[model samples]
Target: MTNIGGAFRRNINRIGADNLSLILALVILVFLITVVSGWAGYDGGDKFFSWQNLMNSVAQAIVIVGLLAIGETVVIVAGGLDISVGSVASIGSVVAASVLVGVGTFGSTLLPTGNVVVAVLAGIIAGMVAGAINGFIVTVLRVNPIIATLGTLAAFAGIAFLLAPDGKPIGVVTQPDFTWLARHRLFTDVGIPDLNGSAWTGIPVLTVIFVIVTIIIHILMAYTDFGRAIYAIGGNEVAARLAGISLTRIRIGMYMISGGVAGLAGVLLTARTTSGNPINGVGLELQAITAVFLGGAATTGGKGTIIGTFLAVILVGVLNNGMNLLGFNTFVQRVALGLLLIGAVAISQWRQVREEKVRARALALQS
Candidate 1:
């Protein structure tokens, strides 16, 4: 019995203080949402989680923001940050919409077939190109990651505006029926029915995409040699370099990965909106950063997990949904999110300090 109890405690410690905090936050938030959701007149069920509205809203936001958070995770794990990702996504949407609809200066009929697959690829490539530019600026010119990405954020958005300088959002009106990309579902109903005896059907297509992306990234970050290199670089650049790790290549590659993933997020965003609004991704960087931080990723880098970020995404989604359902002001939600980030950072720092002290104490005893 003691062995089992000790193992459990050890496992909990291994989860890290920041991660444990997130788990606690998630549990508390869910409880509050469930209890107070009734104040908002939600009638779907006793618990807020039982409400379809809450679930759907969370699902939608998670799919959109989760991908962006994943990209942020990759960058942070490698000791960098990319604020321009939101802009990359914005530009990607613009590029894909323009090409698919054959509108603006690009001319219609570029994809006369309105081929969604082609449009998606175009959007993704646009995002990647933007990311590559960020990588070059930071890795080659040695600009700070934050500064480099911030510059690109403005630049990318400006270019996106140029793509549709008319200031009107590009819709799929002329594009070949690509709306289904966002609308399609998979394994909709393996034969489950609701309490009302209605058939429960397909999960949203984007949700599936989010899951697949999360699983793939989790594997990459947790298992691969590349993942180890990323951690080494983030944890101790000098030692990693001495160990033969190419700092420049790794840094550049990480930014590229960040940008590319952000681009893919843009394609997904385009599908969701069915239009390319240049401003669609505005402020998304903060949201993604907040989620990553809340998920236990340190701003200083070298520590985080895909599962942690994924949970953070869901947590954010639930918070947003619950707040909206409760009729809280939008600014209140923003403030709350900001506070969460601050708290997460504070907790992380505290943990670091505590660990250092523990190490020092052990060394003192040995001496």
Candidate 2:
């Protein structure tokens, strides 16, 4: 019995204090934030994590942080870093919104669903194409990732401005296919003789779509050879190249992934907000990157988990929700977040350093 208990303790400790600490910190903060969330009148009525409010918070987190973290994860795992996620997300949304409007003016009853599907697909593809362009400049042209993305970041935003210079929002009239995304799906038992209760609980279809995309990404990263290659290259691009890995292809792939994921986020945002702003995601990049770092992505690259990033998103969502509940000042909120990010990165790095030391010492002693 003692041996078993001791063994379990040893295994737990091996998981380390750093990760454990973050998990605990997040949990404790959740409760505290929940309490504060009530005060924000977040529901426009109550001091509680009402199902609706909680769902809203989750949706928002998935939209904003999801975009940033997804890109950050891809870049970090490819021996690169991207700080232009926000602009990319905004640009994608604007383009999607524009496309939706263009299709809606068709005035055909059958056009709505087809148009939305097409617009979403095109948006995702466009995002990937944009990311690929960034890769071309960074990898093929040998420009710095940060510098390259930053340039595109500005250019993309400028393009968005040009796409809607007058700041007019596109709607069904722009194409005849607008209402379906807002209200098209029907939920009922298959022509049942007498369906009990309204056969459908009304909810946003986009939620299911977003969750599905995240799941697909998680699987791709966790179970594919290409995924492992991503980590290997990110961990050491020179070593990867020497081992016959295609650094160019890997870098390009990561950027493409970043753009594609951002496109999904863009769809969600347009759906939720019912329109796209020319400057909707100005600081989202920083916040998403912070979330990735906070959730324990290695600054040196090649070390990150989708699950960790996802959890980090939830933690951040709770923090924001809690702040509103607590009636905290908006300005002070971001300041506090900044400090937290710096502190979390410092602690995570320290933990990594300690682990390396311990590992080295163990190996040396064995030798």
Task: Judging by lDDT against the true structure, name the best candidate.
Answer: 1
Task: Please give the range of 10 consecutive residues that has the lowest summed lDDT in model 2.
Answer: 103-112
**TM-scores of all predicted structures:** 0.90, 0.81
lDDT value, residue 232 of candidate 1: 90
Best by TM-score: 1
Which tens-of-lDDT digit does each residue in 54-127 have in candidate 1? 43566767887898999889888777988988888888788778877778655364454366777778787777
lDDT of 1: 0.79
How much is the lDDT of residue 78 in candidate 2? 66
Candidate 1 residue pairs in backbone clash: 102-108, 114-176, 188-201, 188-202
Score each candidate by Cα lDDT. 0.79, 0.68
Predicted structure 1, TM vs. truth: 0.90
Candidate 1 error regions (>4 Å): 6-20, 36-47, 105-113, 173-177, 195-201
True-vs-predicted CA distance for residue 246, candidate 2, Å: 0.3
